[model samples]
Target: MVRAEILAVAVVAMFAGPGGAQSMDKATDCGYQAEVVAAVQQARKDRVGERQVQQHVAEKATWPENYNNAIPLIAGWLYGSDVSMRDIRNEDFAAAWKELCLQQ
Candidate 1:
């Protein structure tokens, strides 16, 4: 029940990014935003540890091969970071993931 609710919220976040981010070429340019949204919600799921969320994303996220590379970083950002999910505004996360790509 809870999982379903979170998944729904994740879907809303993906499409309803601030100021209609879906129109931008930079945001979700590679189509991994769905994966990111799902992973973010999964990372926050009740009683589901980060390890499980990481593993789930690693296996399930399908996009540029970088998904496996980015999932851990995404998981870390969503789970272990100081930025609360409530505080993270739309399309902000794409920049964070882009930073990881820049490092690699």
Candidate 2:
């Protein structure tokens, strides 16, 4: 429940701009965003600490290098205090995030 609220806020913030309508037209961008979410989920499942998530992801990054810039931001949310590692490991957060992103 808490994770859902956080995800909502994050998605809303991402689209909070005058050009948000234009951005929504490019749903392809969310594909990479989803990939980032998946990677972070894997990191959590692998027992990687939030402090090491950035480096850990960079080391085994499969997503495009351009998307590397978003690792820190996504990592913060996945590893934030409000979210538990258990939630990440047990839930399909990457899929949920992608669905929400596409719905925009």
Candidate 3:
């Protein structure tokens, strides 16, 4: 998945308008972004269906409610054919996501 897709939800919330300033702290937002990714990744590993991933995340997420909005997008990317869930079973996507988020 593209970086934009991974960051979309958090980015949208961080910014105000076309050229408006950021409304939230980047570090905290990125951390929440990583949480969303981690939650979705775990749900997928648990065999949660794409259609059910949203609900699964909503029920279990410990992050801010706003961050949960990213669940659908993250789930779609994780469940997409291009990404093999089995192949990523051992990967720490949450850490990778946080690293990328902070770098941006």
Number of the predicted model whose TM-score against the real structure is largest: 3
What TM-score does structure 2 among the candidates reach?
A: 0.70
Residue-wise C-alpha lDDT for candidate 2, range 1-104, written one tens digit per residue: 55654664465455445544334444566666677788988988888887888888888877556556667777778777877767876888777876776665
Q: Write the per-residue lDDT of candidate 3 for residues 1-104, one digit (tens) a residue.
A: 37544455455445334432356677777787888888888888889889999998889878777666678777767787877866459788778777777776
lDDT by residue for model 1 over 1-104, one digit each (tens)?
A: 23323433444344346543456454353346445645665556544577787676666666544435445545665665665556444345544444432232
What's the TM-score of each model vs. the native?
0.43, 0.70, 0.77
Better of 2 and 3 by TM-score: 3
Off by over 4 Å in 3: 1-23
The lDDT for every candidate, in the order shown, is 0.50, 0.70, 0.72
Number of the top candidate by lDDT?
Answer: 3
Error of 2 at 54 (Å): 1.2
**Root-mean-square deviation of candidate 2:** 3.8
The clash number for model 1 is: 0
Which candidate would rank higher by TM-score, 1 or 3?
3
Model 3 vs. true fold: TM: 0.77
Per-residue error for 91 in candidate 2, Å, reads 0.8
Candidate 2 at 19: error in angstroms?
15
lDDT of 2 at 7: 65
